[model samples]
Target: MSIERIISRQYEIANGISNDIGLPKFKKYAMCNLRGGIGKTTLAFNLSYLTNDLLAVDTCPQGNLSYFFDNQYYSSQAPTVRDLILPYLVPGLGKATRVASYVGATNEYFADKNVYYIPSTEELYLLPSQLITAINQALGLQGAQKEQSLKSILYSLKEEIDREMEQNQLERCLIDTSPFFAGATQLAWYAADALVIPVRTDQQSVKSLELLINTLTSPQSEFRKYLPTNDLKVPQIQMVVLTHCGWSTVSGARNEPNQQTKVYLKKVFDILSRHRTLLSTGDPSNHLFMLDDFLGSGRISSVESKPLSLLHSGETKVIDRVRVSVNKSVDKCKHQLQYINQQLWG
Candidate 1:
């Protein structure tokens, strides 16, 4: 079947589901994909503008998202996500700290917006091994019980974040997950109400999507296998963003995705069709959004730690000793983000 036809059919299915059962309102969104360099962090940072009172969580050990929000976090002795999860890892330590105590406001760029973030630390790299050791040493818990205990430890952060949100009146929580589905990323899945997966226009990303879906749905997969025995729930796939899509010029005007992009998009749509139950039901238009490859604009925004909405066209910045100019791309990028935000929360 043609890609367009498949998308139409999927849309019909989604619309029917929406009409029958109603859509879920998601307050916590996890930006995730099994592949890296697909603009997951960028989407998380930009989407913070979706709400005025926002709490962004950096679950990646690399701390890229944390740095973007506040570079000083790396140099200073600030509390991080590591601090929040440390108590659970060490038995002698006191209970987990309040999430609000660890959260810090964003830098000057986001000063106008009430944005707070749980910074990341390089020490999070050691979490997986430490978590496993902690889980195995728990007394009287075996097999599924042990797994449930591990899940509870990982999920504790989410519970605290929920309380923090209630106490502080935060409107939304956005979790920036690591590419690997281990440690903190697992915690992100447990915490999120929904997921926004960003896929690059490439074969590797397609395979990564398949792997991610398997981890979420396949009966024999690591995470899914535990679901039947435990009360664990995986977040639904709320949106699949096709990032870095290329546009070709036709008769001196650029419109629609390029041929290569279309081909991969078909592959993606095909994968999603087989797992319709995993998708969130709502307006079909909200299920997918194509984002252009605004390479220069993206670099500038990341380097400056600003959202596309705050960036202007025709701006030039020196990146790596090269003067890169931002053309009209920023406008389109900003518009796409706004549309996505509206679909998600408007």
Candidate 2:
């Protein structure tokens, strides 16, 4: 499909979804992509601001999403996502824990908007082995029993978060994951109702999409191999957002994805076409969206822990003792994000 047609279909779907007065179909979404540098963290941070009652969860040990909400937060901080998992690591220590105990309020910028998040710590890097040891020692059993036990521990966190959302009256939850498909990333997938996978306009990013599909859908793949039954449901692909797309002016007035972007986009569509069963819509165009490259504005937003919607053109800020201007690109980025939010939950 052409980029213009895809945008039109997305807008049409967004309008229909936004007009509905009922609740959204999916309350939990995971921002997932096996490849890094595709703007997953940035999108998750910005989408959290689309509504006041949304909760953002940082499941990656790298903690980039947590840093975007609170730059001052350190790896040493208490009550991180690690705290939520520690209790379940030991068999007897497991108990009904409140998700609110680990959640922290966002920085001042997001605080007034009533946004909250569960932070992550680097210590989470040690969890996979620790979890494996705990599971092995608990029972001398091997194979499927071990896999089910591990998933039970990981999934308990999601159950607690659901209860917290209900008690606090939150509207939705967005989870940011690590690029690797193991550990916390697995937890995010097991917890999500749907997934928003971001792909950059590159051959490697396109390949990552196929890898993700295989891992989730192929019975021989690691994740699906253990859980062969539909009892542990795999999240459906809600959308595949093309990030950092190159754009060029067309007809002297409108801008559209440049030729290079179109080439890769065709490849993406070809791949998605073969896996229609994994998608939320039969028409791939309805599930595709693009965000033009806005590196200058994105850098400032990341450093300042602010969303593009709050940024303005002609704004200036000092970075490393040098003054930098926030140009009109900020507005373009904000418009793209707003449209995406409408398609997602409006």
Candidate 3:
């Protein structure tokens, strides 16, 4: 398909993902930047879990949504998001589930559902290499086509989501993506109709935001051709730049935050607005715009939980997610969704 086709197709996919699948009416895009430690995984996990538990009532025997919390989420035979989901994308018995949710207890097909997880594992750390190899294979002299290989992955996700809604009552599919750019980031952006970018009000995140804009707008960037979707409506890009604001510095703090952090934060918001405007195709008044999710102002925070790796606590304490001085981060995430609806559909 042409780049325009790919980009426009995302809107159709969004319609399928939302109303067809029974998800929140407004949500269609996703956030899966390659930046690390920006809580991408956390956001994915939390979103999927919440959507499954809250949005849709009917589930499979294995609970396609529930498996994300478990350690043995994917089978060894089919690793990575593409591996587990690709097989079931086309017409098949369990293709209804769309993504591979879980193997039956006997390692057979699902009892009766079509939802699969893009598994996360230590071995999956090899996904980047696997993706590179696949890309190479795609463009060979007698090539299968690199674009199709990537497009297939997106189809796998959308198809499973659509299928599951057919059989069971599957509303939303929250895909947790690997951190950092590689093939995975491309897949997520291509699949997503919109994107939610959560940024901490720190220097590192601010710098990363500028870099992301360059990547998105670059001529060589793969996402450009697909923008503006089919009718040139929906713009095919939704961004939510959240301030990971909280307070809880440390035991002892010598000084307040530096001026550099503030400058960088403003720059991020400015660029974010401009990016939203571009994404909206300079409509002066278009719904495809960026919003801020600020639970509270900035503050240092503590992290008392273990690493998501679930590494055992040793002599020193491990941090699962950072503890924010603000008690409303969770609420903030929720509130932004409402804003998303207002902006996208209202």
lDDT on C-alpha atoms for all candidate structures: 0.74, 0.74, 0.40
**Considering summed lDDT, which 10 consecutive residues are worst modelled in model 1?**
12-21
Error of 3 at 6 (Å): 32
lDDT of 2 by residue, 1-346 (tens): 4446774443333233323222235888999999999999999988888766777889888899888877666744447766776677766665444444222354666656766677878887887787657655645657777667756765765776786677777878898988888777777787888899999999999999999998998788656654447557788888888888876666653445678887887888888888877777666766777786766677778888878788889887888887777877676677678767876787
- On residues 1-346, what C-alpha lDDT tens digit does candidate 1 reach at each position? 3455423333333222222223456889889998899999989888885466888899898888888877676896777777777787786776544444222354676766777777788898988887667656653478777776666676766876786677777888888989998778877888888899999999999999999999987788655554444577778988888888876667653346678888877778778777777888733334666777878888888888877778788899999999987768676677677656655555
How well does candidate 1 match the true structure, expressed as C-alpha RMSD? 4.7
TM-score, prediction 2: 0.87
Error of 1 at 188 (Å): 0.7
Q: Which stretches of candidate 3 lie over 4 Å from their true place?
A: 1-27, 49-68, 71-82, 85-118, 141-168, 222-235, 246-265, 277-346
Give the better candidate number (1 or 3) by lDDT. Answer: 1
Model 2 is weakest, by summed lDDT over 10 consecutive residues, at 14-23
Report the number of clashing residue pairs per model.
Answer: 0, 1, 15
Clashing pairs in 2: 18-346
Residue-by-residue lDDT tens digits, candidate 3, 29-101: 4554545666554444334322331121111122232343433444544333444443432335243233333
Error of 2 at 302 (Å): 1.1
Candidate 2 residue spans exceeding 4 A from truth? 1-4, 7-24, 94-106, 134-151, 250-253
| Residue 9 error, candidate 1, Å | 15
